[model samples]
Target: MRRMLIVDDEPLIADGLYTFFAKADIEDMEILKVYSAKQALEWLDTVKVDIVLSDICMPGMDGMQLIQEIVDRWPRCKVILLTGHNEFEYAHQAIRNPCVADYLLKTEGMEKIRETVEQTLKQIARENDFRYQAEWFQEKMPKALPQLQRQLLLDLLKRRGAKAWMNLQEEFDAIRLPFRAELAVLPMLLRIEEWGSYESQSDQRLLCYAAANIAEELLGDKAAVKVAELDSRSLVCYIQPHAGQLQQHGLEQGWERTIRFVMGTLESIQQSCRDCLRLSVSIIAANQAVQWGGLQQSVNRLGLAVFDSPGHGMEKLMRLDITGETAGLSLRQDKLAAAELLLEHMKQRLLEGSDDWMCSFRQWVEITGEGGPDDPFLRLRLLHGIADVSLRTVQEAGLSEEAGREHDLAPMLHFNIHTRWSDIIAFYRETCQWIVLRRRDSCRLDESHILMNIHHYIKQHLDGDLSLTRIAQEVSLNPSYLSRWYKKVTGRGISDYILERRVEKSKELLLGTTLRMQDISGQLGFSDQHYFFRFFKKAVGCTPQEYRDQRKGAAETKM
Candidate 1:
């Protein structure tokens, strides 16, 4: 249902309009009335008003100002300015605001006003329909085929245990994977070590796709290779022996030959990336092949190995020797794999501004602490990843200088100084906590600065043009956005603030000086003495002379 509010300072006119709307044959509309813009706003605080009919000149916060308040509160609400004054400037200004449907003089009959309101309702309905149609179109559109395939591979790699692979073949066939579920596969993890000048996410993704294409081109003849980019920097390729080669050379010989060819082709892939793309990457291949059920474990181990290795400045081509690492896969290795995955998850959360990343970090620390002794390489990797994200956040938020002064930020950059695992964890937590707090402080400071600028401008221009549009221009913000932001931050409408300031200034002038009423009204930016008198009486509950005389009588009594 739609709601309409009629605002006019005069009681007869406000009631008359309400009675006319209530008796009219308008459908689905709840009509209300208020005596002033301030009362209208107070009603608007709780009720969702769909249309407002207001006088362009009121005692406090006139119709022009009310338009901004309505825009801030109920953006879709239409306003019709009603005034006795037939000024072209007033109509032009009202027409400029998108929410203002019409500027009808009170001389225009009730029929014209009601017709304008009905038209506004239709406009609102059309806008709502367009929004719904746009949303429907978005929902019905299909995602890209490559994105679906990548997501499937990522899900498969993260799945655990044998039960998870029950429907693996059907899922693979859905995305047209070349290999069957029964065949053993080799998983190779690739990490892009350096992108040189390609820093943006889109550029890096293009490089990753190009690099994968180069790998497929080099090793496509020997094995069935399918690559899925796991993140911006890492990709995993699943390789299986081609059916023709396996049938011709036997399973064991063909599989062994395919593995050798893959290993040999890594050098060529690396060279191609360097020569053509000018990018450096690190590659880690599993020492032995695994079935679909064991693929997750092999990929996890390789992920940890690739991430833990020191590949900061150079490309690394290494084989993950899972067989040689302790007799069987140990608990420590599993914990390390879990930790690596958690860190990656935390990185994403940190970028998205979620506090859950801190919880993930704490869980990683607890897992690391419970895993008996710590690996130096694991500690170094954690430190590097955490410090990188922390510093990047600080820099992006423009808090680097403050962070440097508040804590020992230098140690975060140099991981060699932290000798103990506990020291590393403690320092990282401290840095993260500081970053979170400082970011909040910086946001508060920014908000305070904006409010200060707005308040300053309002105070400075009290006698000049204090219209919402002029105030918005002074603050360098859209009038609607400025009104919304101010109300949200200060918990009061900007119009209310302006009214309060004007009242306070009037009181000061009445008590402190003997300025003539007309001069005082002009100085306060009122249209005339009569408007100022009504404004002061409405706010102070007394005329200007009465207020001054009451204060003088009280002062004389005190003396």
Candidate 2:
């Protein structure tokens, strides 16, 4: 509802306007009367006033001064000036202030005043509509721009041939990319070697994005830098020296210095990622810059170098000369890729509450055990991957303590502790089975705990704010989801449960206490006694007083 304040130094005028508006039947509008500018300012301090009608010549603070205060406090509130003097200067000043709706002589009848107030309300509504649309576009543009830039970069990364690079400068400009087209750029690939506590794909992507931000922050001053996530676990950064830097140091020396600075900053970036995000990353950068046309080949070379590097879960920084042959890298890459796929599939199945993940684990073990001598590096990679999945699953399910007590599998993650492949495989199999069983028990316990918390909060706050939004906040859940889930779990709606509780409380108060109807209704959170009486009669098939009398009579007869 909109509130309008009527302020005049004279009591007669203020009270008359208030009485007229109170009886005028202005829908959804509340009129308040104040005798002076001081009283009006006090009211505005605590309440929102939509329109202010005040006399132009008051004693201490004139209507013009009050308008300025209102502008500062509530910029949306419209002010109308009324005065006995029909002075031209007052009208001119009122017209200059945007907050002043109209300047009028006191001789303008209350009807004219009422019409002006109604028009001011319509003006407020129109302004609110325009503001909402502008706010929506402002909110959406920031979120949309990033996705557009990412898609453009991905397209450029995959495009081939000179024709693909024809409009490269225009595409970059459209997205506001910092790097200049046709300039030699330094390309670096960042791979998350170990995802400490992050398990979900979304969480992993967030960490990768944070890592990219850290890269930009550290190296942005030296070069024009743009970083984009290639996947959940990796992102690529393209860096080019700014024009001024290139002119000062010549083209060759400028790129050399920028590349050197980037290489030196990698350690700092890695430290920030480790400290802030708890992620270990491996960075591979080219020792020399590559032309825009050859960016994809350079990125590919860095990817192969990462795949061939040993010690899968440790952080490392490698500089590629961009001229090595990746002949023998394919075989190892295939093996690692297969192992990663199998582990991811098993993780998904386990989270879905299935026993078939054990089958996938067995297949992975077979893949690791296949053919041509024992590659300890490959086994080490598989061991760390499985251990990570198992530990994260146990932690996410809140069964870490139980898993620790039941099995001492922590040492299985260490390569030296379980050097034998057979021993590692046996431990891995036992961990998988333990996860399946414990997860089932954890699910039941989690549901029970959630229901208990929700019910307890509802009971304690029966007379307070027990809205769906409040209850969801109490139990840390989304309001809409909680409503649907609670109904599905209890076979009754939450609102129905609340109504039943209120009725039970009302009955208890009626039969057990000598409280008045108003007191009982207030205690039970009803707005008034009449609403309470109607609600109680509809629910219990009798009015509250009638139900109380009948129950008491039945008890007296029994005695």
Query: lDDT of each model, Cα atoms only?
Result: 0.79, 0.80
Q: Please estimate how well model 1 matches the true structure, expressed as its whole-model Cα lDDT.
A: 0.79
Which pairs in model 1 have colliding backbones? none
lDDT of 1 by residue, 1-559 (tens): 5678899998768867776886684765667777899989987886678889999999879999999999999988899899897999998898789999889989988898888888888987887796767776555534555677778877876665578889888987766677878888999988898999988989998999999888878889888888899888888998988988899999899899999999988888899999999999888898778887777777777877765667454799988786685314444467666676777666556544567778778878887773324566656655665666667667776877787688778876555534666677778777767766666667787778888987888777777656555576676786667767888988997768988989988888888999988878877876457768877998889999999999999999999
Residue pairs clashing in model 2 are none
- Tell me the deviation in Å of residue 25 in model 2: 28
TM-score of each: 0.50, 0.48
State the lDDT of candidate 2 residue by residue for 236-260, as single tens digits: 8888997788899998898888888
Per TM-score, the best of the predicted structures is 1
Model 1: ten consecutive residues of lowest lDDT: 325-334
